[model samples]
Target chain A: MELFPEKYSQAIEKALERYYERYTAPENLYSPARYILSLGGKRIRPSLVLMAAESFGVPLEKATDAAIAIEVFHNFSLVHDDIMDRAPLRRGHETVHMKWNGNTAILSGDVMMIQAYELFESYPKDIFRDVVHTFNRVARLVCEGQQMDMDFEKEEYVPMEQYIRMIEMKTAVLLGGALAIGAIIGGASTTDVKKMYDFGRCIGLAYQLTDDYLDTFGCEKTFGKRIGGDILEAKKTFLYITAFDNTTDKGALRDAFSITDEEEKITAVRTLYRKAEADKAIEKSIAYYTDKALSCADSMPFPAHVRDTYRRLAVSLVERKV
Target chain B: MELFPEKYSQAIEKALERYYERYTAPENLYSPARYILSLGGKRIRPSLVLMAAESFGVPLEKATDAAIAIEVFHNFSLVHDDIMDRAPLRRGHETVHMKWNGNTAILSGDVMMIQAYELFESYPKDIFRDVVHTFNRVARLVCEGQQMDMDFEKEEYVPMEQYIRMIEMKTAVLLGGALAIGAIIGGASTTDVKKMYDFGRCIGLAYQLTDDYLDTFGCEKTFGKRIGGDILEAKKTFLYITAFDNTTDKGALRDAFSITDEEEKITAVRTLYRKAEADKAIEKSIAYYTDKALSCADSMPFPAHVRDTYRRLAVSLVERKV
Candidate 1:
C-alpha cells in the first residue's frame, strides 16, 4: 500500500503548482526561484506536513499554506547553499547561481524567503503566529548547521557525533518543524505535535544516513550522479569517518586521504571502505534508523490504515536508490 | 522640539536594546550580527517606523516590534550590500563580511532576515495579515532594487529617469513600506496609510538627492567619510548625469570620467560640475523634492504641532550639510 494518503499526495501536487504560479511575474526575479523549486525532486518536506495534518483528520487544503511556506523556505536555502557549495548543478540542471550570476541568485533567494512568509499570511491568525515562531527557530538552526558545516571544512578532525548533530540542525530540524507546525495548524493535541516532530526528525536522520550510504555503494545510473562524488570531495560522510575510526587496514585509508591524485584517491578510499566493510556498516545503521523512524510513526494514535501508509512511505525513502 | 513623542522614542530605544539581546546567545552565531547592527549610524528607518506609528496614535510599545523588524531587515541588506560593493568598512567599523568571511556574512545576514520576521510575531492578530503582506512586498522590492543597481553597473547608459526609479525601488520603497505598515498597525484609515507611504517615499527620494549633493559639497571632516568618494568611483550620481546631459564641455566631462587616477578624476569632475553649474542645478532639484515632501506632510490632517515638526524635519533633511 502507498505510505501516504492519496488526498495528502494530491494536495501537495496542487499546492506546488499554485506555489509555482506566484513566481510568474518579474521573470528575472522569479526565474531562478522557479528553476530551483521545480528541480523535479520529491517534495518530501511538504509531504510530511500534509501527512501530519491528514493524520490528525484535518483536510490537506487547510494545511497547504503552511506546507508551501516550508517548501519555499527549503528552496531558498538550496539557492544559497548551491552558491556556497559552488555546485554548478542541482537535480541534473544548472543551479540558480550557475545559470544566472551569484548576485541574481542571492537576490532571488531573498525574494523566495519573503515569498515564504507571504504564503504564511494565508493561515489563520493564531496558527500563523505559531508557524512563524516555529519557522524562525528552525531557520536559525539551519544557519547554525551551515556554519558548523563550514567550520568542519577547516578542522582537522570532526567527531561522528558532532557531524550527526550538525546534520540534524542543518537538515532535519526544518523537516521536524514542518510536521509539528502542520499538526498544530490541524488542531492536533500537544502530544501529537510532539510525536510527529519526533517521527519527522527520525526519518530525516534516516534519510540522510541512507544518502551517505548510497554515495559509496549505489549504482551510478540509479544515483543520477557520480558514484563517488562525496568521497572524491572528501566530504565527511559516515563511510569515510567510520572506516577511519574502525578499519583494520589503516594504511590504505591514510594513503587514500594523503593521495593528491584525484582519481587514485577515490579508488583508494573506496578500496579501504570495502575492505573495512564500512559500506555494510552504514547500511546496517540506515536500517536501524529506518526501523526506529517507522516505530515512531506507528506509536502515534492514528487510524491503522493511515499509520500503515506512513510506514510504507518510510520504507520507500530508505529503499530508493537515489 | 523633536518630532517624535517622547514615549515613542524611549520605546524604540528599549526595544532595540532587547533586539540586540536576542543576538547575545550563541555568541559565535551573533557576534558578527551584533557587530554590524551596533555599528551605530543613525537608526533612521526604525525611528521613522516609530514616529509614523505615533503620528497615527498607536502606542509606541506596540509599534516597537515593526520598527525593529525594519531595522533588522535593513541591517541584513547592509551586511550583504557591503560584500557586493567590495566595501571594506561601514560606519567606521570593519564590515561583517570583511571581519569574518563572506560565508559568515551571508549566513548571518540570513539569520537577521529570520529575526526580522520573528520580531513581527509580537503584533496583535488584527493587523498581522497586513503587516506580513507589507513586509513581504517591501522585502521583494528591496531585492529588485538591488538587482537593478547591479544591472546599472553593466549598462552604459542608465537614464536619469531609470536611475530615479532604481532608487525608488531600492531605497524609497522600504521607507514607504515602513511608514505605511506602521500606519496600518496604528489603525489609520486606508487613505492615511497611502498618504504616509507617499510622504515617506518623497522624503526618501529627497534624502538620496541630498546625500549626493553632500558627498560633493560638504566639509570633509563632517561628511563622515572622504569627500567626492562617489565622484572618485565614477558613480552615475545626479550631478554627473545632469552635467552630461546639459554641458557643452563634453571633453572635460569625458576627461573626468576617463581619468584612471582617483585624485585627478575628483578634481576634474568638480571643476566641470562647477563650470556647468551642475552642483547648483542638483541642489535645486533636491530643494524641489524636499518642498514636495513637505507639502505632502503639510496636507496630512495631523495635529498642527506634528505637521510643523515634519516641515522642519523635511527642510533640515535637505538643507543640513553632512
Candidate 2:
C-alpha cells in the first residue's frame, strides 16, 4: 500500500508533462497555461484516476488520457475561478489573470477547456460516446455549482444542506467523474463504475471538510496560507455556520461577523469557534465520510493489496499536512 | 428560394427558444443568455448551416443541431467580447456585463459555451467523432484569434496579411465550421464539404470587409451605430492600413491617428481617407472577396436554386440600406 503512493505520484508527474506538451501552442497563448500548470498543486484528481485504473487491473499508463483530461479540466476551472474571485495569487504565484490581462486569461482558459476535450477525444471510438456524454454532464454541473456559489454571495442566508450540495456539484462531482472515467476506460461494469463514483464522492466531501478545518487551525508551514482567510472574506464556510448554530454566546459571534477591524474579527471569531468546539465537529464529520468512502472501496472486487492501497490513500488525504 | 428564407429563420428561432429553456435556475443567469439570444441578429451562421444542408438535399431539421450550435457559439463569443472590449451595448441594448455584473456575464458565457458542446453532442453516434473533433479544433482557433486581436491593441504595426488571418480565425472559422458541419451531416462528399468550407471562409472575409466599409460610409440608420468608430479608436481596419500605405500625406494621417480630441480625430481621419480615396479602396476590396465567395459557391455542385439564393443573400448583405 505504501509503495503505491510513490508509484502513482511518479506516474502523475510524467503524464502531466506529456499532456502539457501535447497542448502547447507556438504562440504565447499557452504561456500563462504553462506557468499555472507548473505552479504545482497536489495533483490529487489525476492521482485518483491513475490509482483507480490500477485497482481495476489496468496499468497506470493505460489511464493516462483520463487522468490528463481530469487535471486539465480542474486547472481550467481554477483559472476562470481566479478571474471571477479576483484572486491574484494561486499556489504562491500570480494567477493567470494577474500575470497577464483578463482577456488573455479568459482566452487561455477557453483554450485549456478545448485542450481538455481534446484529451478525452484521444480515447478509443467505442468509449468515446460515453466519455463525452459523461464529460458534458459533469461540465454542466460544475458551471451550475459556480453559479450557485455566485448566487450565495448575494443572498442573506444559505442553509447547511444547500452549501453541502454546492460543494458536491463544484468539487465532488469532478472527482467522482475522474474515478468513473478511469473505471469506464479500464473496462469496469456499470455497477463498479457507480460504486467507484460513490466512493470518490464520499472522499471528496471529507476532503473539503478537512480543507475547512485546515483553513482555521492549520500551521502556516503546512497550510500554505494564513488561517481565517475564509473568515476575512465572510465565505460562510462550515465552521462559521456550525458555530453560529451551536454557540450560546450569540452576541459576540454576531458582532464578530460584522466587525470591520481584521484583527478584531479574526480574534473574536476564533474565540467563539473555540468555545463552540467547531473544530471537533469538523473533525468528526471528516472521519465519518472518510470511513464511508473507504467502506465503498472495500466492497469493490479488487485484490486485497489494491483495495488496501486505495483505503490508505483516502485516509492520508484527510490527514495530510502539506 | 424566398420561401426557404422564412422556413429556415423560423426553425432557428424555435431552436434558440429550446436552447434558452435548458437553464432552469437563477433567472438572472439565464436572463443575460436569453437577452442576448433574443436580440434578433440576422442569424447568418445558422442560415448558412441550413442553406448548406439543403443544398445537399438534407432536410433542414436534420441540420438543426449544428445550426443551433453555431449560433450559440457566436453568442458566446459576443458576450465575452462585450466584456473584453468594455462595450456598453450590443445589438443596441445593454450587454450582458452591463445588465448583470462582469462575473455573471463571464459565468453565463462559460455556460453558453458548454451548451454549444452539448448541442453539438446531439448528432448521431457515427458522426459524433468528427463533430467533436472539428468543433474542438475550431474552438482552439477562435481562442487564438482573440489573443491576436488583443495583441494588435499593443502593437502599432500590424501587417495586412496578419489582420486577414486574425479575422479568419476569430470570426470566419466558426462560420466555416457551420457550413462544414451542415455539409457533413447532410451526407455531402468530403470534396463538397471542403468547397463549402471555402465558400464560408471567403464569404466571412467579404462580410467583415463590407462591415469595415459600412462603418465609415454607410448611413447611421443602415449601419446601426456611429460611423467611423474604428477610425476613432485608431483600429487597424483595412481602410486605415490601405490609406496608411498609399497616401502621400503622411503627416496629416499620423496626426489623425494620434489626436486625442474626439471630434478632431474623426474629422481629420475622414478627411484624409476621402482624399486618399480610401473609401473606394475599401469598396473594391469588399467587392473582390464578395466576387470570390460567389464564385466559390457557384463552383460547388449544389442545386441552381441554392446557389442563386446564396448569391442574392451575399449581395444584399453588402448592399443593404437598413
Candidate 3:
C-alpha cells in the first residue's frame, strides 16, 4: 500500500512548490533557503504529514502549511549543521557555508528558523498552541542531540544507551513530532495521536540505523552518496561506538583509527567491525526497532485500511519481509 | 515615572533571576545561556515589555514571562552574533565561543532560541497566539537586520537612508515588537497597541542614534564601554556615513580613515566629523525623533499619569533638557 490513498501526495508536492516563491530581501539571507528546498529529497516527512492528516479525514489544505514548515525547518538545521561541521558539500552540491561565507550561512539559517514558525501561522487557530509547543520541544531536543554528537568526539566511548538517546533526539524526534502534529490537526483522538507519534518515532530510529548500515555495506551506486565516508572522518557513529565497545582489543582499535592512509584505515576499521560483529548487531537492532515500529500501528483504533497504510510505510522504510 | 515607579523593575529582575535556575543536561548548553544573562546590561527591553503591559493595566505577575522571554531571546542573538563577528568578548567578558568552542556557542544559541518560545507557555491561553505571532515576526526582522548589517560592510558608501533603515531593522523593531506584544496582552485596544508599537519603534531608532553618537563623543568612563571603538574597526556607523555623504572633501575623508596609528586616526576622524557638522546634525536628528516618539504617547487615549510615565522614559533615553 502507498503512504496515502492517492492525490494528497501530489497536492503536497504542489504546495511545497508554491512555498519556494516567497521572496525576502538581501538575497543572501533568503536565496540559500530557497535553493536548498529546490535540491529536493524524498519529501518523506511532509508526505507522512499529509498521510497522517488524510487518514483522519483532515483536508489536504489543512495540512499543507505544516508539510512545508517541517521541511523548511529540516533545511534550517542542515544549513547550520553544515557550517558547524565545516562540510564542503551536501546532497552532492556546495553546502551553504561553502557557497557563501559562514556569516551568511549563520544569518540565513537564523531567518529560516523564524520563517518555519511563520509558516505555522497557517495552522488552524484552535490547536495552534499544541503544535507550537510540540515543535519547541522537538527543536530543543534536536539542538541537544547535536551537542551530544559533538561531545562524543572527545570520548573514547559513549555508552550504547546514550548513543541511542542522541540519535533519537538528533534524528527521530522531528519525525515523531511531524506525525503527532498532523494527527492532532486531523482531529484524531488523544489515543490515536499518541500511537501515531510512537509509530513515527520508532520508524525514524530504524531509518537512522539502516542509514548507518548502508554507509558501510550498501552498493556504492545504490547508496547515491559515498560509501565509507563517515569512517574517513573518524566520525564516532553507531557502528564505531558499537564495534569499539564490543572489542577486547580496544587500544588496537584506537591506534587503527590514527592510520594515515584513508583506504587502509577504512579497510582496517571494516575488519575490526566485522570481527566484533558490530554490523550484525546493528542489523539485528534495526530489525527489532522496525518490528516495534510496525507493531505500533497494528493496534491503533483507526480503520483497518488506515492501519494498513502505516504498515506499508514501516515496511518500505525497513525494507524487510512483512 | 521610572518605567513603573521602580518596583516593577525589581519584580522583573527577580523574575529573571529565578529564570536561570531551569536545569537542562550536559551543562554545556544551559550554563552559557545562564552566564550571558548574568552579565547584565540595562535590562531595557524586558523593562519596556513590563512597562508597556503595566501601562495597559496588566500587573507584574501577568507580564513576567514575556519580560523574561524577550530578554532571553535578546541574549540568544548576541551569543550567535558574537560567533559570526568572531568577537572575543561581550559585555566586557569573553564571548560564549571564546569561553567554549564555536560548536558549543552555536548549539547553546540554538537552544536559547527554542527556549524563548518555551517561556511563552506561561502566557494566558486567550492571548497566546497573539504573543507567538508577534514574536515570530520580530525574530525574523532581527535576522534580516543582522544580514543588512553584514551586507553594509561590503559597500564603500552606504546611503544615509539605507543606514538608518538597517539600524531600524537590526535594533528598533524588536523594541517596538516587544511593546506591541505587551500592550496586546494587557488588553489594550487595537488602536492603542499600534500607537504603542510606533512609539516604541521611534524611540528605538532614537536609542540607536544616541548609541552611535556616544561612540565618538561620550566619555569612555560614563559610556561604560570603549569609545573610539567603531572608528578603530572601520565600522561604518551613522556618524561615518553622514560625514562621508555630506563632505565635499571625500577623498581626504577616505585617506583619514586609512590612518594606521589608532590615536591619530580617531583624532583625524573626529576633526572631519566636526567639519561636516555630522555630530551637530546627528544630534538634531536625535532631538527630532525624540520629539516624534514622545508625541506618539501624548495622543494616546489613556489617562494622563500613564502618559507621563512614557514621557519620562522618552526623556531619559533622549537625555535632553525638556
Candidate 4:
C-alpha cells in the first residue's frame, strides 16, 4: 500500500486552504501564517491523525478539522523555532522572521496557536474537552522539550537516557497526541486509543532517529537536503551522543567535531561515527522502534489490511532517503 | 463597596501562588512565568471573574481556577508584548526579556499560554468547551489588536473608529471574556452573561481611555509614572488622534509633535490638544463609557447591592487618579 496517498494530502490541503480564507485581514498577522502553511511539508502528524480516524471507521470529515489543527500547530512551532534558532530558510524559502520581522513572526505564530485550539471546537462537548486536554498536555511537553534542546546546546554533557526522553517529548508525543485525538473523536475504546497513541509515538521515535541518521548517511541524489549539515553544526544527534559513549578515545571524537573546515568536519565526524559503531547503534535503535510500532499496530483493533498499511507506513518513513 | 475588595485580592493572590508551585522543572521556562506573576498588579481581571461567579451565586472555589487562568494569560501577553515593545521595566522591575533573555521570554510565554488553557479543564465538559472557545476568540482578538497598534505606529493616519476598535480588542475583550467565562461556569443565563461581558467591556474602554488621559495630564506623584511620557513617544493616543482631527492648523500641531526637547514637545502637544478641545473630547468619551458600564450593570440580573457594587467598580476604575 502507498504511504501518505495523494488523496489524503489533497484533502488536507483543501481543508487548510478553506480554513485560512477567513483570516485575510490583518495581513501582517495572518499572511505569515498562510505563507508557512503553504510551504508544503510532509504533513506526517496530520496524516497520522487521519489514518487513525479512518482505521477507527470514522468519516473523513470527522477528523479533517483536527488534522488541520495539528498541521497549523506544527507550522506555528516551526515559525517560532526558526525565529529562536535565527534560521534564515525553511523548506528552501525565507522563514517568517526573515521575510517580515521577529515581532511579526512571534505574534503571527501566537495567533496560529490559538487558531489551532479554535478548530477543535467543532467536536461534541465531551470529545472537545478530551481533545483539548490532550492537546494542552502535548503542547506543554513540546515546549518543555524545546527548552531541553536549547539547554543541551550549552551543556557539556547529556545522559543518553535524558537524550532519548528529550526526543520523545519534543517530537514523539505530538504524534501520539494526534493519533489519540483522532481515535477519541472516532469513538474508539480507551485501550484502543492508547494503542494508537503508542503506535504513533514509536513511529515518531523511529522517524526522528532515521532523520538524524540520514543527515550524514543519506544518498546525495535522493536526500534533497545537503548531507552532513548536522555534522557541520556539531548537532548532538543520536550519532554524536552515542558515539561519545561508544568511542574509546572521546577526545578524538571531540576533536573531530571541533574541525574548522565544513567538509573536513563532516568526513571526520562520519569516520568517528563509524569507528565508534554509533551508526550501527542508531540503526539498531531505529529498527527497534519501527518493530515496536508494528507490534502496537498488531495489537490495535484495526483489520488485517489496515495493519498492513500501517506497517508499510513505518517502513516507508524509516526507509526514506530524504 | 470597594472596587476590588482586599479579601478578593488576597484570595486571587493565594490561588495564583498555589497554581505556579507545580512548575518547578525547566527553570528557564517556568521561572519567567513565576517572576511575572509575582510582580502583582491589581488582579482586576481575575477579580472580575470571581466577582461574577459570586454575584451569580456560584461558589468562589468553582471559579478560582478560571480566574488564575486569566491572570496567567494576562502575564503571558505582557511577557511577549514587553519583548516586542522593547519595554525595559514592568511594575518597576526588569522585563522578562531583560532579566532572562528574549528566547527565554518567548518560550516561557508560550508554555504559560498552554498552561492557561489547561487550567480550564477543572470545569465540567460543556462549560470547559464554552470557556475555551470564548478564551480562544478573545485571545486572537488581542493579537489582532496588538498588530493594529504596531501598524498605527508606522502609518500616518488612523480613523477614530478604528482606534476605538483597536483598544476594544487589545484590552477590553479580555476583561469581557473574564466575566463571560465565570458566568458560563456559574450557569448564568446567556443574556445575563452577555450583559456581564458588555459591562466589563465598557469599563475597560473607560479604563484604557483614562490611562491615556493620565499619561499627559495626571499628577506625577499619584500616577506612579512620568507625566507626558506619551507625548515624548508621540504615541497615536486618543488625545493625539483627536487633536489632529480637531485642530485647524495641522501643520503647527505636526511641528509641535516634532519638537526636539521633551518638555517643549509635551507642552506644545498639550497646548494643541486644549486648543482643539481634544482633552474635553476625551473626557466626554470616558464619561460615556463609564455610564454605559453602569447601565449594563443595572440591567444585569443581580440584587440591588450587586448592581451597586458593579456601579462602584466602574466608577472607581474611571475615577482613579493613577
Q: Ten consecutive residues with minimal summed lDDT in candidate 2 chain A?
A: A1-10
lDDT of 3 at B223: 85
lDDT of 4 by residue, B26-67 (tens): 888898999999998889999999999889888887899999
Q: For candidate 1, write residues B16-70 as lDDT tens digits.
A: 7888876664455678877887776666678788878888888777788899889
Cα deviation of B32, candidate 3, in Å: 1.4
Using alpha carbons, what is the TM-score of model 2? 0.94
Write down the DockQ of candidate 3.
0.75
Model 1 segments more than 4 A misplaced: A1-27, A54-65, A244-252, A271-281, B1-17, B24-28, B56-62, B247-252, B274-277, B299-302
lDDT of each: 0.81, 0.82, 0.84, 0.91
Residue clash pairs of candidate 1? A3-A309
Ranking the candidates on TM-score from highest down gives 4, 3, 2, 1
TM-score for the B chain of model 4: 0.98
Number of clashes recorded per candidate: 1, 0, 0, 0
For candidate 3, lDDT tens digit of each residue in B1-322? 2434577678777887777776458788788998898888778888888888888888877888888889889999999899989999898999999999887887788888888888888776657788888889889888988988898888887888888888888888888988888897898887887898888888999989999888888888878877788888888888998898889989988998999999899989999999999999899989888898889989876799888878778878867211
Clashing pairs in 2: none
- lDDT-wise, the better of 1 and 4 is 4
How much of the real interface does each model capture, measured as fnat?
A: 0.57, 0.57, 0.75, 0.85
Better of 2 and 4 by DockQ: 4
For model 1 the local lDDT of residue A290 reads 80
